[model samples]
Target: MCSGADEKGGEQVAGRAGGMAALPAGLAAAPGNAAEARARYFNSANAFNIHLDPVPAHIFTAPAAAALGPEGAVTGYFLCDQSARLGCPWPATTPFMLARYARIAPGARLAADFAASGSIWYVIAGKGRVYGAGAGAGAGAGAGAGAGAGAGAGAGAGAGAGADAGVAEESALAWSRGDVFYLPAGASMLHADGPDAAVLWLVTDEPLLAYHGLRSARPDDAAVHFKAGDIAAEIERIHRSVPDAGTSGLAVVFSSEAMQARRNLMPALTLSLNTLPPGCAQSPHRHNSAALTLIVAGADCHSRVDGETCAWSDWATLVTPAGAPHSHHNEGPRRADFLIVQDGGLYYEARTMGFEFLGG
Candidate 1:
C-alpha cells in the first residue's frame, strides 16, 4: 500500500491487522501464535518521533524555606519533585537528576541511602560532619577525596585540611556552610549536624539510573569535600583573574583526582559554583543539559529563563530545562552565588552538549 496522509496531516499506516494499524501494510502481520502476539512494530512516521513532556523550568521556594526554617524543624528531606510535570514515574527535578533539601536539627543525624551512581551535596547553612565508608578520614577543598585522601593525607593535612588521625579510616569528614561534596555509588552516609541546625541542598542522578533499569556497581571511592574557606579563597582568586568581558562567568568547577581527567563530579554529573557580580548579568545562553541550581546568596536577583522571570530566593532550588535560553541577573548590592549541578558530563561524553551563547 502507498503511504498517505490522514485527516490530521500525519502519515497514515496502511494495514490494520486485528486493529493493529500502527505498522505499514507490507510489514503488518496478524498474530499467528502466542510468540507472534508479543511482537509489535511501527513505521517511521509514528515510532521514530516520540515526544515526552519537556521538563519544566521551575523554582522551588517552599521546600527551601521549610528546610531553612527554625532550629526545631524536623530532620527530613524536602524533595523538589517534578515527576508529575515531566510525565516521569520516579521523582525527578530534571529528567535525569533528583534535587532535594535536607534539614538536620542540632546534633541530629540522618542516614542517606540513595541508589544513585553518585551524589552531589552543598551546605546551605550551619555546620556538620559526614560519617560513612565514602567519607575520607580527612579531606579539604580543592583536593582529591577519593583514593587520593588515603595517599596524600599526610602531606596535605594542615590548616583548612584538618588532621583527624583519631577518626576511623572509613568515617567522619567535617563540613561547614558553603562547602560542597560528592560521594560515589553505595556510599550510605550519616550526616550529623553540629550545635546548630543544618540545611543542605543535594542532587543525584537516581532518576537516570532508574529510567535505565540499572543499579550502580559497588563503588570504592571515598567522598570528596570542598571546604567553605578554600572555596572562598579560590573564588577571590578567580574574581581577580577574570576579565570584565570576553569570558564565561567566574564559576568554580569541582572535580576529584579520579575524575580530574574529565573535570566533572561524576561520570554523568557536572558541579559548579556560579557567581553574578553586583549589578551584572550573565549573557543569555542555552545548553542541552538541564541544570539544578541552589541559590545561596541572591538577595535581589532573578533569572530570565526562556523569557520568563524567575525571582531568586535564598537556598531555593531552581531548574533550567534543557535548551532554555536563560540569564542570571544580580540587582542587589552584593554578588549572587549559586551552586549548579548539570548532567552535562553525560552529554559531554556523548559529544552532544550543545552550549551556545545567544546574541542580543
Candidate 2:
C-alpha cells in the first residue's frame, strides 16, 4: 500500500505564518492525516483532480512583439482578474487594467494628462523624467473619488515647504533606468524621454474604480516613483538574513502600502524584486494572493505554476493565480532577477490568506 505522503523539500513564507491548509473546497481535508490525503490527491495516478477556482496573476514576454503605436512604443497587455470570479465592473473587484509597454521616442514626452485611478510605471530601459504637480489634477484627466487621490494633494502640499516655497507651486522628478514610479489618483503628469528611447512598463488599478462608479479612467495618475537600487545589496541582505532551508532565492518587497505612515503611494498593490543564484531554484509554495512576475534582468530561469511550465526569457511576464503552488529555477550561470507585483496587502489585511510549503 503506497500511501504517498510525507514529502519534504522546502519550507513556506508569506506575509502571514504557515499552518495547515483548508481542503480545496468540496474535498475532504484530513485535519489529523495530511499525508494520507496528499497521497490520494497529489501523487496517485488514479487520484481525482479537483481544479482550483481561479488565480489572479499574468506574465508577458517579448512585449516588443506587440503591435507598435505611431510613436513606436509596444503597448502590450497583461491582465489580472483578482479572484478569477469577479470582474472590474463591480466595486468589489481589484482590476489591474490598461497595462502598457510604452516606448517613448528620444526627447519626446507623453502628453500630460490626468486620471481617476492610481497607477505604477517602471522604467525598463533608456532614460526619462516625470513632470507633474498637485494642481494639475484639476485640469487633466485626474478627478473624482479614486484610490490614492488624497496622497497627491499631500505631496503637493509637502513640496511647498522648501525655501523656494512661494515659487514651489509645481515640480518635476527625473528618473533613469530601473526606477519604479507611482502616480496617485487625481494628479497630472507627462512622461519626458531622455537622450535615448525609453521602454516603460505600466500597471494601473482603474477598472475597479470604473466598476464602482468612475468609468472614464485615463493614463496619467498620481503616486510616488520608487527607483530600484542595485540588486547586489538586496541579494547580500538575503544571504545574511534568510536561512538556507526555505525558498532557494532572495527577495525584497518594495511596497508603498507597507510604508503607510508617510503618505503611502499605493493602497493595495505591492511590488518586489527577487533573485535566484546560478543553478539554484526556489522551493515551491502556495498562498492566497496572486502575483504578476516580470523577468526584468535575467533569462536563466523558467517558472512552473501548478503543473504547467513556461520557457521564459528576458522581458517575459507570468501571472500566478491565487493559491497555485509555483517556483522558478535559475538554469543559467548568472543570477535571475525579476519583478513581482501583487495584491497580497488586501489579503493580509482581511486575514483571509494562508501560506504553505510544497516540495519543488
Candidate 3:
C-alpha cells in the first residue's frame, strides 16, 4: 500500500490486527456476484490505481499468530475485492491480492500464514530473511506458535524454514535495496530480521491457496533457492543482445523486449522494465492485459488514465486493467525507471475470445 500522499492525510483504520471491520461508510461493497462486480470495479475510473496507506504495525492472532516468530513484526494486508468494487473490469476468472510486511531488529520471525495466485516481494528498504516451502510438506504442519519463553521457535517446522533439524542447515534467501523476488505457485516463504527491515508483498488469491494446500500435504520437502544476484544476472543476460530496450528515454517496444526472458521465470505473466529520459512524454496507449507499474527511480511524472491525471514519484505503485486507455509523461529533469507486470495468459485468452484493442 505505497502512496504518493502523506500518511496522515489518507484514510486510517484501527489497523490489521483489529480483525474484519465493516467497510467505511460510502466505501462500496463487493458486488452480489463476482463477475458483475469485477466488471464494474475494473470499469470505474476511481478504481484505477487505488493505493492503500501503509499500516504501521504487525497484526497477528493466537491461531494465526503461530506463523510468526518472537520478533516484534507486522503482517497486515490490503485486499481488493474484485467482485464488489467498480473500476477496472477485472477478469471474472482471475484472482489478485496485495500485502505489506515489516519486522524490527534483534529477532527473526515468521509473520504470515497466507499465500497468493501470483506473489511478488518488493524490497522498499532495509534487509531481511525469506523462507519458503520444503520439497515436501503439508500446509498445516507447525503453522502457529503460542505465547511463551520458546514461542519464537515453536512453530518452525514442516514445509518452510524451521522445519526439520536440517532446517538450520537450510539457508534463508536474503534481500537488500531495490531487490524483487517472485514466488511461484504453491511456494512457501519466511523472512528473517535485518537492520530496519520492511517489505511490500503483492500476490494473487487462487495461487496462494493452492500453494498452502501443497505445503499442507508435504511438510518436510525442500524448495528451490535463488538470490538477488541471480535475478540481476538474468536481467543482464536478457539485455546483453537488446541494448536498445535499455535506453534511458521513451520506448514502446522496451517492455515487449524485456518480456523475452522475464516470461521464463513467470510463464503465466508478462513483465517489462523501462527507463524514461528526462522531460520525455510517453504517448498514451491501451492494451488487453491487467497491468501494474512500479516507479523505480526519478520523480515528477504525470499519468493519465481515462482522462484522469495523477502525479507519480519513486516507489509509487499504479494499476491499469485491460482495455483501459492510459499514458505517462515524465515531468522531472532526471530519468525515470519503471517496472510493469501484467497478466499474460489473460491477454491471450481475451484475444482468443475476440476482445480486440484499437489504440496503442
Candidate 4:
C-alpha cells in the first residue's frame, strides 16, 4: 500500500490501499467477463506513454449544453462523454463517468435529482446557497450529503482552523468560488443559484449504473457549498510547508473527515489540485486508475500521455486513461493549475492501486 515518495521528502506521501495491480489470469474464463475486466483495467504490458495527438482531445471539451430543465434556465457542460472514440473502456461496461461544467441561472434552483453514482463538485465562480437532507452514506455536497458505502459522511466533516468551519449531515451551507464538495449517489440534491449565477465543474460515477441498465436514476443537478475562498491561500500553504515539493509546481489534495467519503475510490471518486510552477515539468508517474483533469489556472499547458501530447487553455479538460503513463508541463510564464478527479480509489479498495514514478 505504499505510494511513490513525493519530492517533498515524503511529506506528500499519499496513503495506499489494496495491493499491487496486475492483470488477472483466466479473467477470460469462468466467473469473469474478459470484456468487463478489460473495461476496468489496461494491460501493463502495453506502453503507458499516451499523447493527445497535436491538440488536447477536443471531443471532451464540447461547449456547455444549455436549457437543462423545463424552465429552460439552467446551463451545463459535459466534459467527457461515452461517444468519444478515445479507446476508453469506461462508460460502456462500468459506470458512464463524466466531468461537467455548469452555469446555474440566477435565483433559480435545480429540480430535485438523485443518481446511483457519487458526484464531486467544485465552485469555480460566483456564490450560492446549497441545501440537501440525507443521512447514511451521504452529505456535504450540493443539496445532499452522506458517507456512502466505503466511507461515511464527508466533505464538510473535517476542517482545519478556519478551513471549512462546520459540516454535518446537512447540506445547508452558503458557498462561493473555490469551495469543493461531494454528493453521494441516491442522495437527493437541490440548489438555488446566487443572484449572479454559479459556475462549476462536476465529476461523477454514473456510467456504471447506465451500463447496468439503471438509466432512470440519472438527472441534472448541482455540487457543493464548502468554499475554499482563496486558491492562492491553499497554494501558499503548500509552498510554505514544502517548498519545491518536486514535480514541477506545487499541489494539494481535498479530502473528507469521515473514514468513508462519498466521492473517493472507496465509495466512488475523489479530487486533487495540481499546480505547476511556470515552465516546469512534473515527474512522470502512472497508476491503475484513469484521471479527468480540468484546467483551473494558468494557460497553454500541454500534457504528454505516453506518446501523445495535447495542449489546452484555461478551463479545458484532459484525460489520462487508466494505466497510461502521463505527465504535465507548464508552457507559459504563469503558474498552471488543474483539478484532478480520478477513480484511483476503486483500485485502492480492491487492493490493486499499483503505481510507479519516473523522475520529473
Candidate 5:
C-alpha cells in the first residue's frame, strides 16, 4: 500500500473481489493525503504520448494587405498569427517561428526590440534606412538616439543617402524595395522610413525562445545586408552555372561570413531565395523543418502542400507545415520568385532534418 492510501483495505478488497474496469488514481492523491497531493501518475501505455493541435498549412493574405496597402497613415504591425490553432500562449505563425508585416509611415521610425535570437527582413515596398546597434548596445540604441547618431539624422535621404552619408553610414543600411537584411539577437534596430511609406516582411525565432523560457543573450555577429541587385545577380549566376537536371531548384541561400560554415542565416533559421522558370514545377519533397515563405514575384503560380493547392498572391505569406509533401509550380510564361525562411538550422544541428524527395 502507498503511504497516502489509508483506504487501501477497501481497494484491496475490491481488487480481490473482481477485476477493475479502469486503472486507479495515484494512491498519493487520495482525498486526505496532503504530503503527496500534487503527485500524478500514468502507465507505460500513455505516459509519453501526447497529441496537440497541428500547425495548419495556411496562407496569410490579410496581414500582407494591411502592410502593403497605400491607405494606412499610422505605423503598425500586422501579425500572421495562428497561436490559437497551435495551442501556444504567444503569437506564432508556425510552432517555431513568428512572422509579421510592418508598415512604417513616412518619416516615422519603428523600434525593433523583440525578444528573439535573430530576425530576417525583406523590403516589400518603398525605401528606408535601418540602423542596427551591435549586440549589447542596450536601450539607447533601440530608442533611436545613441546608435542612430551615425546613421544620418533623418529618413528623407532614401537611396541617395547611402553614397554620401559618410562614415556614419557604416552603422546603417540604406534599403529600397526588394532588399533583404538580417539582424542578430540581443540588439535592436531603428527603421526610419524615407519620404514615402515602407512595408516590410519580418520573421523571427521568438516563439522558440518563449517555449524554452529563455531570453537571447548578446550575439557574436553583426547585421548583414543583401542588396536586391546582388541577390538577383547571384541567382542568375546559379542559373547559368548549374544544369537544370543537376539541381533540385534554382535557388540561392543567404549566408554571412561567420555563418558560412553552417550556410544558414542564423543559428536556428535558414533563408533562401527560390525561383521556378516558366512552365516548370519543382520536385515534390519533404523536410522536418516548417517553412514560412514570402511570395516575391509570381503570377499563375501555386504550391502543392500535402495535396492541398495553395495559390500565390502578390506580397502574401504562406505557411508550410513540417513533414508535408510540397512543391512549387509556375504555369505562367514569366518566372516566379519566392523567399523562404525555415527552422532547418536547428534540424541540421540536431542531425534530424530527414529531408527526402517524394516521387510523383
Candidate 6:
C-alpha cells in the first residue's frame, strides 16, 4: 500500500531503503562512519520506521551488566522512563519511569519497593518468586507466613475496614515470559529468583521509593499467584477458535487468565495476542492511546512508525505513543506472536467523541 507523494504530488520514495533518501535537508550529519551517517539520515527522516535488520548479534547472549550502548543509554534499546537516576528521589512524583535489565542468580531473592505511580513487570528470561498480597489483601494489610496471626489481631476491628486494607495490600502477582504484571499505586511487593537464574525487565514510574523503605509495611508471607503455561496450549486454543487462522493478523478479545488479570489493574488496558503469518503485511493504522507491544515468539518481524521500519525480534518491546500512526509487517519466514497492550477505554472514549483511523 503506497501513499501518494508530498502536497505537490511529486514522486516520493517507497520502501525502507528508498525512504532513507528523503531525509530532511541539513540533518544528515552523523557522529561516525558512512554507515552511521546513513543510519542517522534514516533515523531523522523516518524516526518511526527505522528498522535494524538481522537483529544485532550481541543482544541475546550478552550479559545484563554489560553496556549495550553509549553511557546512560542502551544501544538499540529504548528505555521508557529515561530521566530517572539511580538512588535519587524521583524527579516527579506523578509518573516517573525507569527500566533496568537485571539478572538474578539461581535461588537468589531480590526485593523491590512499590512505586508511588505504580509499576509493570515483564519477564524477559528465566523464572522467579513474586511476593505480594493474597487475593483479599488491602492497602496497609500485613502479609507473610504469619498473615493469619496478623489478621487475628485486627479481627475485632470493623469488618469493612479490615477487608479494605487487605485488598489494598495484595498487589504482587506472578509473571513469566509474555506475562505483564502490574502493581497498583501504594502497594509494596517483592520477587525471589526462580529455580533457574532469571532476567527481568523491570519498569516503573517511581524509582526512588524502593522495597527496603517499605519493609515495615510488608506482610510476613510470600505468594506465587499466576502462571501462563506452554505455548502449545495457547496455540491450541487459538486454532480451535479459528480453524482457518493461518494468516498473519491480530486477534483481539481472545480470552486468557493473564489477560483478565491485566484488565483488572488497568480497566482501560486492552490485552491481546497477535499471530503474524509469514510474509503478511499489516497496513498502517493508529491508536488514539498509548500502547505497549511485546514479541513473544518468532523473529525478524518488522514494524514501521510513520515511515521508519525495523525488525523486532522475540522479547523485544515496541512502544507506540498515543495517536501516532504505525504499522507492522512480517519480514521473516515463520509465524510471529506478539502481546499487545493498549488503552481500550481511551479508544472507546475517543471514538465516541469522533476520532478516525487513517489507513496508510
lDDT of 6 by residue, 1-360 (tens): 246355455565454336654655344455477765655333444657544221111122232333122232221212333223223343221122234444444544333333333445556666644443332233235322211101111212111112222333234354565454554443332333455545555444333343224222223322223345644466656766754433334553333343354342333344456777788777566655545566667667777765566567656556555556677788788888766655554356455412344565
lDDT accuracy of residue 76 in candidate 1: 69
lDDT tens readout by residue for model 2, 227-265: 556544665778688566655357766655435652224
In model 2, the runs with Cα more than 4 Å from the true position are 1-58, 67-98, 111-117, 133-170, 214-222, 230-232, 240-249, 256-265
Tens digits of per-residue lDDT for model 3, 211-330: 244322333323333344664565556545454642333322221222344332243455455666688777566666655666667678867766667567545556565556677788
Best by lDDT: 5
Question: What C-alpha lDDT does candidate 2 achieve relative to the native structure?
Answer: 0.53
TM-score of every candidate relative to the true structure: 0.82, 0.63, 0.54, 0.63, 0.82, 0.52
TM-score of 1: 0.82
Note the clash tally of each candidate. Answer: 1, 18, 50, 41, 0, 27
Q: What is the lDDT of residue 196 in candidate 3?
A: 51
Error of 2 at 34 (Å): 54
lDDT values of the candidates?
A: 0.76, 0.53, 0.44, 0.55, 0.77, 0.44
Q: What is the lDDT of residue 305 in candidate 1?
A: 93
Best by TM-score: 1
lDDT of 6: 0.44
List runs of model 5 lying over 4 Å from the truth: 1-41, 135-169, 244-246
Give model 2's TM-score versus the native structure. Answer: 0.63
Scored against the true structure, residue 105 in model 5 reaches a CA lDDT of 75
**Worst-scoring 10-residue span by lDDT in model 1:** 147-156
All models, RMSD in angstroms: 8.5, 14.6, 15.8, 14.7, 7.1, 16.2
lDDT of 5 by residue, 1-360 (tens): 542233745355334624332444445735566657767666543554568899899999998877767654556667899999999988889988998887777766665656687789999888876665452223224323221111211233122222212324455678888888887764344455656788889899888988998877864667788999999899989888856553668899999898999999889999999999999999999999999999999999999998899999998999999999999999999999999999999999999999898878
